[model samples]
Target: MSTFQLPSSTATTSTAYSSDEEDTLPYPGELSRSDFLAKDFNPEAYLSSLGRNRHQTLEDLRSDLRSRSQLLNQELLELVNGNYEEFLSLGADLHEGEERVEGVRVGVMGFGREVGGVGKVVREREREMEGLLVEKRRIGGEVGVGRALLEVDARLGEMEEGLGIIDRDEDEGDGFDEDDEEVGGEKGSSPVLRRLQRHTREFLLLTRMVERVGSSHPFLLAQQGRVDAIRKTLLLDLAAALRQAKAAKEADAMLGIVRMFSDLGAEGEGVRVLRGS
Candidate 1:
């Protein structure tokens, strides 16, 4: 029902009221909506506050309440009518709320699966990259080994070539120095024998390194025969040079040659040559 107000108490002229309409008589400007707004509002108490002035009969009050209720009902009906289309739309959407929620759930699940698949692919790629890195390191190590072996082989070849060149020069001159011991000066090495000393020392050191790698190392093993040939050729050259120095009576040259033998790890061979000479 629509809200109404009761008037406040004030001076009012007395008019004897019919018992049936005792508190229902009207008093002009004495009622307002604020009268009913009190926290403890009561219709009987509000009517009694009017004192002797009567407004109307009890049946009239009942009639006013009925009218207010009908008016409120009419207003509520109008409100519902005003947004009738929106109310229908809301009802329809609510009816389909479950299906919409299910669709959203399915979409989320599919996205999650895709994300998981991408993560799996990324992990697989990471593993592949790790394997590639390991392979790269192995290849790099092998390349380094190849370079070392190449260096060793090249050095050996150069030394062998030098030996041949020196041998050719040996028959060309006396190949002696002022330090030659044949003239009775203090013993000292000639230039020709000094070259041989260097050759023996370097070759022996290189060979020792190769041997330490183990005879079973495939690359060095394959080069073993060549290494042995170089060693044999070098020893022969040393022996011939020793013989030539003794024939020339060059003790200093011979001393240097024997030292070369020791450097080549062939001191036993030098001892035998000395015995024979």
Candidate 2:
């Protein structure tokens, strides 16, 4: 028997077999136009599923990191601001001390003129001048310390701010999964996320560099040296003022030491001592 099938029946059979094969074949959940067109898409679910596929963790980690970074930055900024106020206070104290030093220098210069039995008065002025010079030295040292502290605080604040920015970028980037294929009709890679990551990396590097520079700063050392010099000068000036006062007392008793000889003569010596020569 010749088993010849009708042409129409054979065509139908081929179509049925093709359809069955297609139904049995596995269909990967590829993004389709229908998925994009769906209005009720859950972004959070999409992100989660995308993360699962890409091995990316949840967004909670990024959020926690960002919160911590912000807190740290805020605290550091407050510390820096506090240090600035302290610096200002130290500067004011230094200025006051400088004024006192200037007053002492003027009094010593004036005493050398020896006006109308002013020898006793000059001796009293010298004592006061000596005390002021000592105070000036102490205040100068305090100012130098304050300045160094302020510099360190400022650098720390800057580093914290940079870290905060980096953390924020990380949180934002965590939203997009790198391995997730474009779902639906979405076009191209995310430019915003890429830019954010780049910026964060740059900021982190800059902060680290600044911190390194600040930690081993030479300017702070130089300022400390200046403070030490000023302190030493103050000590020398105070010693000289006391000596002049003693000399004036001796001249008063001897009556032979005239105003010109005792007062005017000591002027050159006083100037030299005050200048730390």
Candidate 3:
């Protein structure tokens, strides 16, 4: 084969591989570059810098990942601690519930589980309620009786007032002139006599009530006695006034006077009028 000769340089030349030439050499893989700029391109050094950049990025990523993982672990630990504290509280509450259940069991055993005692207590309470109802009824009856007595007392007061007015009118007069008394009695005696008759009837009604309730209320019996005395005094005074008024044909007064005498059991005085003398 004929050898091919390259052109010789005029100055000294190095036979060693230049950095640019080494960069241009075919690597293990199919890669190439411009031989003129291969020294400046420096592919190996560029690749080393790229590898360093990749490693530095990987290291920084790993450090950040480690710090994040540490934070996650701390959060997990706190969550676990919180859950553990809740678990402990729940355990204590469960223990208290168990104690309360045990106490209930002890109480049940102490009472011998007798339901009869509870029933007996309920029955006694019912009986006490019944007694209270009975007392309430008794009080209601007493209140009714008291109201009736009060009405009777009011009527008696009206009668007393009328009698007081009559007494005052009689006292103010000079004396009982038979003619004047006859004229006045014909006009005025109707009212007084009617009032007296009404009082007598009312007194009889009151006496009956007093007789019925007097044992329970002793004061009512005393009141009845006073009423009876007043009735007798009023009848005697009214009879005397009528006898004086009868001379001038005071028929109504004479009739009322006779009725009062009969009520007082003074039959002798009542007989004098019945004979028309």
List candidate 2 segments past 4 Å from native. Answer: 1-117, 164-277
- Candidate 2, residue 198: Cα displacement in angstroms equals 17
Report the lDDT tens digits of candidate 2 across residue range 1-277.
8897779989999999999998887543433435434788875786566556543345654664467568769988999999999999999999999999999989977776656358778788899999899989988876865665665445433333333422344434333445453332123423322322332333344335435545345654444443334333333333444355455554331222122123323445444443456
Number of the candidate with higher TM-score, 1 or 3: 1
**lDDT, each prediction:** 0.72, 0.51, 0.62
Model 1 lDDT per residue over 46-143, tens place:
76764345455667656665775687689889998978978898889987987898999999999999999999999999999999999999999888
Which residue pairs in model 2 clash with each other?
none
Task: Give RMSD (Å) of candidate 2 vs. truth.
Answer: 51.3
Give the number of colliding residue pairs in candidate 2. Answer: 0
**Worst lDDT 10-window in candidate 2:** 252-261
User: Worst 10-residue stretch by lDDT in candidate 1?
Assistant: 8-17
Q: What would the TM-score be for candidate 1 when compared with the true structure?
A: 0.47
Candidate 3 — which pairs collide? 20-38, 20-39
| Candidate 2 to truth, TM | 0.19
Off by over 4 Å in 1: 1-112, 165-188, 212-214, 217-219, 243-255
